[model samples]
Target: MPSLELKAPSLELKVPPVAVMLLVALMMWLVSLITPVIALTFFVRLFIGAMFAVAGIAVALAGVISFMQAHTTVNPTTPNSASNLVDSGIYRFTRNPMYLGLLSMLLGWAVFLASPLALTGTVVFILYMNRFQIKPEEKALLNVFGEAFLQYQAKVRRWL
Candidate 1:
């Protein structure tokens, strides 16, 4: 009998976080316009969305600032480019503060659109990020930072 062969799995569709969020945003807009399953009033939706958007932007920007201050790379595609194990500021709360922020923004969009179905787009974003973006990044971080990375992982939640 011949032995079976298998191929190694690789990251498919290497997309930037911002690009993915943009895609989700586009989906939210299209779904809201076309479907509009939720019937939330304009003022209510706007207020909720605006608050969430502001908070998300703040958190994401804080992560960016922390990276810049640490002088580490923030490019998600190449986690190996990261120079330090950032464990301060917004990073102290969540290991993937930036990704969390993006998720929040997606949630805000979902609320603004007032479409229950559009919320799936947010879940899709998280699922994609977890499998493709964060997992691979963790691998690279473990390789680079070793125990420190592991410690950070232990202390900080992946997404808070």
Candidate 2:
């Protein structure tokens, strides 16, 4: 059987990860601006706000952990260039903790905004990551680590 070779076109002109993140956040804020006022009671809004705050903190912590583990280049689709394959800590749970973290943060923002449109933007972000980031990274990891990558994939989900 022929080995499946995964390939991605050169992304020479893509936006940086930080820039993409900021753009997503900005978009969420824009969504909040257009949201209609609701009749939610003050205490209920406060409770929801607190939930969002907690989610934001959790996402921020995950981002910090991901940054610490990021000893290699920022490109996820180039596992061959990685100094190490991080499979411990949060990595053991989900292959894309950083993306998950960002998603959680965006979800928190959506909640804080009390805007359904902002939540929809968060869903769009997830879809974008699955297509552009996670899929390419999975392919690159399989190419670089072969059986090891497959084993990890079996043990842990792409997201948790």
Candidate 3:
């Protein structure tokens, strides 16, 4: 009988996170064009749009906070590229604040466009981020930061 050796799968993939985000945004724009739903009154739409804007702003602020905390370059796709591992402020809350910020911005665009299809794109974006961006980044962080990364993971949610 031949003995089989089990090997772990490769951690990295070639897909760019920015490309994924752009694709989601494009899909949302397409949906807005097709469905063309004016579901809310102007005032209500404005309010919802404002709320989404606030979300985007908050997400951006989180990203800024993360960047400042790390005092390093901001590049999510390359976790090893980071000079420091930030576990403070917004980093304390979510491991991927930049992605969260981008997601919020996308959601804001959808709400401002007033398209249900755009909202659907937000769901797809979240799913993709979880599978591709966040997972890989976490693995890289674990390898880079070791137990410190694990401890941070235990405390901070992936996204909040």
Per-prediction TM-score to the true structure, in the order listed = 0.90, 0.73, 0.79
Off by over 4 Å in 3: 1-19
lDDT of 3: 0.76
State which candidate has the highest TM-score: 1
Candidate 1 residues 87-115, lDDT tens each? 98998899998999999889999888888
Roughly what TM-score does model 2 have, to 2 decimal places? Answer: 0.73
Candidate 2 residue pairs in clash (backbone atoms < 3 Å): none
Q: Which ten residues in a row have the lowest lDDT in candidate 1?
A: 4-13
Q: What C-alpha lDDT, on a 0 to 100 scale, does residue 135 get in candidate 1?
A: 88
How much is the lDDT of residue 118 in candidate 1? 91
Ranking of models by TM-score: 1, 3, 2
CA displacement after TM-score superposition, residue 129 of candidate 3 (Å): 1.3
As for candidate 1, its clashing pairs are: none
lDDT of 1: 0.87
Worst 10 residues of 3 by lDDT: 5-14
| Comparison by lDDT, 1 against 3, better one | 1
Clashes of each: 0, 0, 0
Q: Which order, best to worst by lDDT?
A: 1, 3, 2
